[model samples]
Target: MSTTGFDYTITRTLDAPADRVWAAWTVADEYAVWASAEEVVLDVRPGGAWSSVMVIPGGARVPLTGGYVEVVENKRLVMGMNVPGRDEPVLMTLDLTADGERTQISLSQTFDTAEDRDQAEQGSNFLLDSLTTHLAAA
Candidate 1:
């Protein structure tokens, strides 16, 4: 999408180091666990591609595809996400900042409309919560 700016932004602090949190996000196996995906393939680098198949509530599989626009290990990631049913891909940015033993994550995403942004915010929150649970168990 040719969006001018990010439409939604959310931040959360995880009780783990930046490297640990970064691994959870970039490692395919770790991501699949927290994301509840049936399969995941992540190529975490600039110009790299990633894809996942998520099993929804009714056991329906939804495929997510994306390409990395920017990548900075343990620091930041920018991706162009090809969301289903959308005409254009959404631009998503994740920034990680370390604070002693904790890592603060800020996620920003662009959507075509306010409603879409609001909906995405809810989904993002759920995913972040799952990440927290996954880290706690690690």
Candidate 2:
């Protein structure tokens, strides 16, 4: 984990290829399996919309919507997240690089306030852990 300015970043080296990791981010079905959400809807291109209903523990549902700001196949994806109760959208960037058979996924989420950034870190970490588990089971 790292931070600079108003951004919080997390990086993980996964035992999966970059392409597979890209698919998990871009494809709704693949994403649903590991996204810590009940459903995922993603168009996956620049300017496309990304939305999901997260089913947190105890069955509480949280809906989140966002749009893709940039997309680079198998490499990078930048999203503008429209979080509920927030006036501004947070920008998240996922940078992937191949490390032999594995891939390094770097996630940077920039928010307008430190409180917002801190609030998201735990959930972000859990989702990454879920992704790792999902890949291990594949």
Candidate 3:
């Protein structure tokens, strides 16, 4: 299989169709509603910015923001995320597919270190869980 410095890929199926799932990602209001468990905002277009304030236990909050690099309708999305004092930004890619009754989503990310990759995988899994919860309500 293809590999990056440290590969991180997460795949899941949503009960919704690909188009509907894509909608949630592309619509700022819709995204904030389902994609996050805390304060979040998305610009929803290429070169647009996004930010989210995620509150952890003990009331600690972490904030992340970035700009979308590419957005392919119902298929692919790529974004560059801000990370502290790094020579390069973190990149995230979403590959999506629609089956008859479900949407299959895969997120691929590369990191500079194995630790960084693991951390991102953990955070992304949580975010995906939150996204699932949001879609369940739709």
Candidate 4:
């Protein structure tokens, strides 16, 4: 299915450089840490594929698969994530801006319905919170 527009967007500033923030998304090990994934494989180039097995609460494992549509180093990334139970992959765009020692990140995702988008916001916030913690420790 084709998405008309993004349904959800969230922005956060992290206490880390843009490069580091980018690594957290592009690097397998770093992504695994913050994403709470059992395994992660990332190919951070245009048209490259990425996959991860996320370990959710109660020991359930969920597989996430995606492909990179665009990559601009520490500046921007756009990908399509195949969420379970969805007919089409969700388009995700992440933009990063470096402000001295901090990085401002804006993430947008497209969903088919407003209810789905609203429900996903909570999970997105939790994921970003994990990223913040990982960055702080790094």
Candidate 5:
């Protein structure tokens, strides 16, 4: 893939409603159940802060901090991510569309540099996959 693009996007059709998926992402306890984080603190509204501490195998902790730029219940969300050691914040948008009893999500993360975007892709995919599993267990 070319490193010129400013955003990297991933789309998934989940076997759950938009509201359910939205709650899973926005609620601290719910997010912790599905995400790759050992701890989560989320305030689901514009200007609110969202943070998590991810614990990798063998006990390495990686902290992530972000703030909500925009939020629309069960529909859309835009957040800003402050990557460790990076001066610029990465922007992420999550759009949800209802599809009968299911939901289709389009997630896009825009970075200041291609290197940052590329580095984030792998973990993003893992989180999405975890979401799928979490929904299935519900």
Candidate 6:
């Protein structure tokens, strides 16, 4: 079996409603609590820019910056996230769906190279897990 090309998706059921879960992605305060896990200044509107510095498990702070390509009010989001050493930005799209008392959040990322895509999937899913934990805590 050969794994070629790069496409990854992480879906999490949040205890919060779609609105609250969406807020975690849209607002500055809540976005910091999860995605970056540190100080994050989010500009969520279409064409807006955002950045974050996250404290890793070993106390290292990784800086991430991105721009919002699309924002569909509480429903969908498309962003371009950049890794410091990479030239091409990874493209991401998140779909928020309401499921009874919970929200089903799906995060999808596409990368230029298979390695970059695989690496991004492995790393970013951890952040999504952290997001679930943060939202559940709140």
Q: Estimate each model's TM-score.
A: 0.91, 0.91, 0.86, 0.91, 0.89, 0.85
Better of 1 and 5 by TM-score: 1
Clashing pairs in 4: none
**How high is the lDDT of residue 22 in model 1?**
95
Give one digit per residue, the lDDT tens place, for model 1 in 1-138.
345643878899999999999999999999998998967999999989999998877989999898999999999999888877877678788999999899999988877677888888988899999999999898
Q: What digit string (tens of lDDT, one per residue) describes model 5 on residues 1-138? A: 235566788999999999899999998888988886867999878889989998776988989899999999999999888877878667788999999889999888866677867877777888899999999999
Q: Compute the lDDT of residue 62 as modeled in candidate 1.
A: 92
Local lDDT at 109 for model 6? 77
- lDDT of every predicted structure (CA atoms): 0.89, 0.87, 0.82, 0.89, 0.86, 0.81
TM-score of 2: 0.91
CA lDDT for candidate 5: 0.86
RMSD of 5: 2.6
Worst 10 residues of 1 by lDDT: 1-10
Better of 1 and 3 by TM-score: 1
Q: What ranking emerges by lDDT with the best candidate at the front?
A: 4, 1, 2, 5, 3, 6
lDDT of 2 by residue, 1-138 (tens): 224557778999999999999998888988988887766889888889988998888988999899999999999999988867878677888999998879999888866678877887877899899999999899
Q: For residues 45-107, what per-residue lDDT tens digits would candidate 6 score against the true structure? A: 988998888777888998878899999987999989876787866678899999866999888
Candidate closer to the true structure by TM-score (higher is better), 2 or 6: 2
lDDT of 3 by residue, 2-58 (tens): 365888789999888888888877777677666543567777688888888766658
Deviation (Å) of 16 in candidate 4: 0.1
Off by over 4 Å in 5: 1-5
How much is the lDDT of residue 130 in candidate 2? 95
